[model samples]
Target: MERFFKLKEKGTDVRTEVMAGLTTFMTMAYILAVNPAILGTTGMDSGAVFTATAVASAIASFCMALFANLPFVLSAGMGLNAYFAYTVVAGMGYSWELALTAVFAEGIIFILLSLTNVREAIFNAIPATLKYGVSVGIGLFICFIGLQNAHIAVDSSTLVTIFSFNNSIKNGTFQSEGITVVLALLGILITGYLVIRGVKGNMLIGIFATWLLGIICQIAGLYVPDPDHGFYSLIPSGILSAPASLAPTFLKFDFASAFAHPLDFFSILFAFLFVDVFDTLGTLIGCASKADMLDEDGKLPEIKGALLADSIGTVVGSCLGTSTITTFVESSAGITEGGRSGLTAVVSGIFFLLALFFSPIFLAIPSFATAPALVIVGFLMIQQVVKVQWDDLLEAIPAYVAIFAMPFLYSISEGISLGIISYVILHVAAGKSKEVTPLMYVLAVLFILKYIAL
Candidate 1:
């Protein structure tokens, strides 16, 4: 036993481990809604897309547990969805099927890069701030998503009019907008309390409590969705199976339209490769930095395995009608729950697989029930804006650009574009021109071209 893996030698027992797994599961439950919503909107069968999303999550989680030996969970990523849906399809006028084809190609490219460790060279070559620029930019991008989903920012009508939905129905009567605002605000407060106060499975508890209260007040009604159509009630098979979609497609890979738009093709290629590698690496690095889990040599043995799993998951997902699968930051919430090893991931993965049996029930939970939790999460992301280097214009410009542009631009890629362009300009103007590399200059030019053309 003494010679076993670090997990056993770390003095954790089975009971303690199980609790850790449960906490990890609850903390990252936010992904259940986030990933599905993004992929489903891509015009895939909502049920089938959700099924692939969950299966990809479970497979990636299992790979992390068995191969990576770390506690991090993997799922369809936040920023990656915007790249797939908003950028590739909507922005560039590509069809969803073509986008899926492109996603598969990118995954294969990622696998090759990871295998040859080309990503490592780029990782080492880039200046730390550029990485910071990319990450901080991505944070803004993710925050924008949270806000848009919560409707904190709505498109204006008749020359950009802004208004709240003020009509919250109650017991066959209308409540004052002030009262609803206060209630939504109160819901935010309570959910924030549970998370900050360290309640066990805080997100789950917050969601359940809010929804239960809503039903009691008739603010929400419980209804079973089509059993065969939602996340939990069924895991559809046949044409919908992950292997069926991916394997055949990969074998018959398409490139007829690949070079149709060279810049767009290259930009799409660059965005996926750049965002996926750096973002995933950043997540792994951030969690490692937090958990004291880095090796004495300051390395994660699981890095290579996790990379493989993530790349495979991405290809599989596109084939199965979904978006890119990347390592999730939600795993950090699991860290707060005392999950120290892959065992936690294994249990959480099992839980997700079993989750398919109860999609109708889970889907029945009203959006408002989760609204409070989402609002709190938005605040969490918003707070990152303050951490920007306000005292120094050099850092502050890019920081503010990333933080504000995300919500304003309504696209993570655009927000990141603004951040990168600003970072490059500020760095050059600061007379520390050497700090900005040739590669960064290239990215900056690309960012500029894409946004202006858009």
Candidate 2:
């Protein structure tokens, strides 16, 4: 019984594990918006969506710690959220309520697939190149999603107009919002400086630095509200009524639409399941690989538990109105920040849960503040392009399409779809059809139907 968690035999400390969980959560701090905005386009009230994100993330993170036993944190996937908001709601014209319904159904299907072992099997069947492409694609997709959320770019006729105060704010006549932007840039600079200097806990330090700047903004009377409202910002919980009031919608299910379009709902379900499982696996394996968390047998400890918790989190989050929940890849950023073990995740989760009380604070930090981080993470995501052996179109074309399609298509699923189809087509066209594995063909067919033909 004690061997179940590796605690009794591996000699784990409960407090240390809790701290590890907390640390993992912090790396995911950006997710508070990633989920709701996607869900928000489905027509939910923004405030209500924010409140729901807080509660759902809290529940999901808790489950990740208690059940998964892996040093991973669960939040709204960045790319997934963009798809939810931009593609599902805005592009596809689905109601926010219906999108939530779709995401929930996907969660149910994921549970069934996990139970049947089909989820893992399907993942194992995918080509190694596709795996690498999808993983890298998701990172670029995240940065693109982040940038759009922060409103750093606006679409226009032909080229686009980018928002920037850089070199524009001079002579002491700066926009009020400029203050937030400067502090955010300061956060990015500090984080980069720390990384360059071999500093530990740089992410924590950066967040703290920005948080302190936020405080300074408050003291300087930047966000003073009407005195009639008593100069206090409305905590999202005050609107939702807090701890207990959250229970009603936290895991509430909406199966009405599933009955209306069973097949469509199921297709999206398969999509969600496919993306979440591999995304979680990729994130865990990536970070664990970097941290040397894998054992001599090349197996990561607590990975199965982590996956189990991740599957459970999706089920839980759907009921709470968020999209499919999964482990985040940005935990590598925390690994870069020198977090070891589950303590990292626990810290990150605790911050996410606590963030509910300060929705205004998170909201207060404007998009301009986060834009630079988006740019940085985007560059970081595309770093995998170096691994694509340009000498061979077999590797280069599909990988390039996967990397570029993310932001251009504005959908993670679509980016993956294009990448897969291109891989199969290029491999066959280049006389490498014999190398085109059957499983690749299966995925390629599905990708084509969902994204291209469908």
Top candidate when judged by TM-score against the true structure: 2
Model 2, global lDDT:
0.59
Candidate 2 lDDT by residue in tens digits, 294-334: 56544555655566667777767667667667777665555
TM-score each candidate: 0.70, 0.74
Candidate 1 local lDDT, 88-140, one digit each (tens) = 77777776666777678889998887788665544443343333444444444
Candidate 1 clashing pairs? 232-356, 232-358, 232-359, 233-359
Q: How far off is model 2, as Cα RMSD?
A: 5.4
Model 2 segments more than 4 A misplaced: 1-24, 33-52, 62-69, 78-101, 133-135, 143-161, 164-172, 214-241, 247-257, 260-307, 356-393
All candidates' lDDT scores?
0.60, 0.59
Candidate whose lDDT is highest = 1
